[model samples]
Target chain A: MCVLAEEGYTGTADVKAFLAEHHGLALSDVDGHLYHHLNEEAIRHLFRVSSSLDSMVLGEPQILGQVKDAYGYASEFKSIGAVLDKFFSKAFSVAKRVRTETKVASSAVSISYAGVELARKIFGDLKDKTVMLIGAGEMCELAARHLLNAGVKGIMVTNRTYERAVKLAEEFDGTAIRFEEMVSHLKTADIVISSTGSPHFILKRDDVEEVIRIRRNRPMFFVDMAVPRDIDPDINDIDNVYVYDIDDLNNVIETNLEERQKEAGRAEEIVVTEVAAFRRWLDAQQVTPTIVSLRRKFDEIREAEVAKAMSMLGTDDPKTRKVVEALASSILNKVLHAPVTALKNDGNGRDPMELVAVVRELFDLTDGGKDCE
Target chain B: MQTLLLKSTTATYLVGALLYLYFIVTLKERGARLGRMFLLIGVVMHLFGFGMRFAEAGHTPITNLFESLSFFALVIVGAFLATELRYNLRVLGAFVAPLAFLFSLLSAFQKSELQSLNPALNSSWLPVHVIVLFIAYAFFAVQFAAGIMYLMQERQLKGKHLGAIFKRLPSLDVLDDINYRCLTIGFPLLTIGIITGSVWAQDAWGTYWSWDPKETASLATWLVYAALLHGRLTVGWRGRKAAIVAIVGFLLVVFTFLGINLLPAGKHTYASIAR
Candidate 1:
């Protein structure tokens, strides 16, 4: 969770105290962690988060889209100013560079996604196929969600606890079937993702053979995400029926993990180069105000001298006064040129702030005593 | 002019078959589209040539082997186009278009000179029996192609080898559906063709049933499909089992139509019937 706020504003501390007072929980009570990233660190951290290099599943593609949505909402509410706006847009481009230059997000690294990929190979299109979840485990629900996103027609969830089944069904807007009648419902299922705690096989070869007959031998895919295995391995032998246990999914995920590790190293290199480029932009931004003030001070003195010469010469001719004013302005710009150029050219391996301070001091551009440091 | 058209039809079919085969190997949709376009053009040229031949022969041009084979190729490609339009089975062209090209090539090699119709085949039922039976064979040919695809995909699934071919083939369910669809249509046409042929036999030879090699072979093919259709409707025999039966039945259809014609024991031989 990144917070884009004004300088010197300690919103993180305020949020921690608010949580303690309102929720009766200390900041550390929930194993909560926070990091405050200042100007340069903030840019680098945002690049990592949006690129998904810092995620639990490295190179997952969803984080960049989520960050884009959050940026959209913050912009709509006018929460961010010019600095944050530029920072976020730069971060988005950096994330895109990481994605295309590295092979990080090219494969399915999660069990649920792997199941979806396998199901597509069997079923062609899942739009008209039904998925049945035999238990209410988190893995089962997650696999169901992935199948739903893949466009399965409907979901049927059955758990040992009827209420749990009903709760999960409502979450997916699916039907809740009785656990005992789950076998009868198997005929309608094209894909079954089962993760039950039963000590034995919930779906055996004979049970699936009967169901396949009822289905008129339409292909059925079974994803068994259980420890002891809720679906029997022999079920795979039945024609038009497939069973993929947790180990198969783990094998796929492990291979993808190995591939992603190699790509992650490449992605980190991209982040480093991008952070350096953004740092140069930040250095330029830092000296802009000093340059603006220095020019303004020189113009002020030039204007005073021009008005004094015009009044003392008592020149009533408008053309003569214009010529004097133009000369004074030209001299002011010529004197300010070299210092201003040095301040703006920040990528030369020189400190821009030191240059800004010297220019300010030489011209006495700072307030009398307030901003002397 | 008709000979030129027939020769062009053969060339077009060859090109189309090659394009579809390329589509299969490359997994490219553009090749399939171009193949379909060539097939459509070939079918048009084939129909035009058949019409001109009918005018020249003063009867249905299916009186000889060359005409029959060419007509058979036309219907097979026609049936495939209809199936593709209905099912979007684009990849099937790779399997099916080559069969059409083979038949057309065989037709092109035969004696294509126009000959007078046989006096025995002068009755109106000649067209009804032969055309109906050829259409059935065409549909059966399509079912055979789909069955092969089903078997290939089922092997990929059963063997757990999800390679490039697996991705190119249609799902088991869709291929099975095509099999059943072709069976339901082909079986009835085949039944009608057999009944009409027996009726025409009664009028032409004073016998409703004779054990001519062609007649016996067609009956055997009929029985194979009848059992397949019955098994599918009743016991729900589908997927690998159904695909195997459909393939075997089509092989029998091929033998009844082509192989039996080569045997001298049949009165329905191209030499005996046409001369």
Candidate 2:
């Protein structure tokens, strides 16, 4: 749930114990196992996480950017090596492919979208309606943006701190009103979107009742996106007044989640295929050390054999010894060619580890292979 | 050779239209890219066809129904390509390419045997007048497509059940902006075309004012756009209302261009299929 900073570990228990010591918290032990992965499993996990398959708000786009930033920071500090480099880069690509090839992230998944959708139901078009936000909360700013994109005529912002309200209003290119004067300007808004931190209802029935009297009987929609709610629930009983809270907006978000879940199935398949491709590349890469050792062993044997034969034949002439060395290496190269090609190209998709084991036994290749370990 | 050129243009347009239609239907990004490529190719072929016809006839080639329809389709695809570049709106091509294909198809099937110009049609002003009107029709075609997309996007937004078409289409504001922009450009060109035709009529027929069906219908089209523009400026009438007017005006353009020829009375009858 929280970002781990500068924390690298080779095992799960170390991470758990570190968290417990740093934060004085303990994870429940009733579960079968706390999820953990290393190496390829870790790569697949990061790929799914970056692609938003593991996000609660399925198909949301922010997690990929966050993941990229994390990987970027880790690489900047020289903490990541070849394994993580390939894994994170491929994760970014898989995320991009899922984003473009599937309709996974097309639908907006926020409480803000629900507010805009509800306002649209009342006005049919937001092009002529005015929306007033009552707070400087993140929810208020986001809902205001959605309403603006839907073509609201104007926006009004009001906060207890007038300066903050003015700042938020400036961001939306909207007019800011003083908190005390919000009731007077309430009649100007056709859709009132409020997400304030107030403990009690900001727009009471009496205030709206008076505003309704000032204007004729035009309908007004109220979206209270705050926890503990900003608008009075009884306002729904008012004529032509609709009020929806966070839970009501959640229903809309849940429907959007279901839609994205259908698309996520295709996205997961893309991630899986990319993982398999990356695995093949990694397996081929693993064969490189054994190939290097095999060539080293063959060269050493050729040099030793040529020296022994030159003295045994009593041939000190450089031309005669040169012919012998060339003849010896040609047979070695021809023997190495087929096995090298099989390992490099992976033509039949044979198990690369088994092939490596065979080469190790056949040629007694061990020097450069041990260097790799 | 000219007939073959026209046929080839039609074939290219057919491919372009199918690609664009499939792009819209499937929301395929590659289809849009390839569709744009084919549409531009079709435009190039159409321009070559027009150039050949002009060379063959020794004049601007829109003297009859067959030639005029081909010219109209050419200007439409040409103007459509220019707008697509300006806006970077591939979806607009999806809505307009089919009209180009249909017109090109009709042009190919029509009697393409070149006719000696009826003496009444020999005025130099006739070519300029027809070309300007068709260019105006080209912008109107853009307006029609933009309006349809505006309504469709608006419906999708309001209905709250967006599908592939909604996602492929542009924003409602962009679509509305395109509609208004096309109207502003099309209306004045149409007015000038109408004025030029009246002058040509006066010189040829000895009268500047004739309430013939083509004249009347074009006048009606002009008035609709003019009123819409005026409302946009003075009363701020736009969006769905402006889109509807633009659509209605496009219908009037279609009618004045060809439907009036279907009627019994008009001096323009010899310029059409009845001859």
lDDT score at residue B199, model 2, on the 0-100 scale: 96
- Grade the docking of candidate 2: incorrect
Q: What share of the true interface contacts does each candidate keep?
A: 0.44, 0.00
Predicted structure with the largest TM-score when compared to the true one: 2
What is the C-alpha lDDT profile of model 1 across B195-219, one tens digit per residue? 9999999999999999999889989
Please list all clashing residue pairs in model 1, or write none if there are none.
none
lDDT of 1 by residue, A1-373 (tens): 5566644344567756765667777768733565677776777789999999999999898899999999999999987655567678888988898887777886678888988877876777789989999987888888899999999999999999999999999999999999999999999998999988999998888888888887877789999998898999989998878888988778767877787898899999988888887676555445776777777777788889999999998977999999998999888788877777787785245444445545666877654323111
Q: What TM-score, over all chains together, does every model reach?
A: 0.69, 0.74
Give the B-chain TM-score of model 2.
0.96
Model 1 misplaced regions, further than 4 Å: A1-109, A120-129, A151-154, A175-181, A184-188, A214-219, A250-373, B271-275
lDDT of 2 by residue, A1-373 (tens): 3233211323466666666667665555412345666656766788899999998878888899999888888889876655456567888888999999987887767888877765654456678889888887777788888888889999999999999989988999999999999989999988888878889888899988777656544557788878788899888766556677777677656767777889988998998887777766555446787788778888999999999999999979999988998899899999989988887764245555556656676876545323123
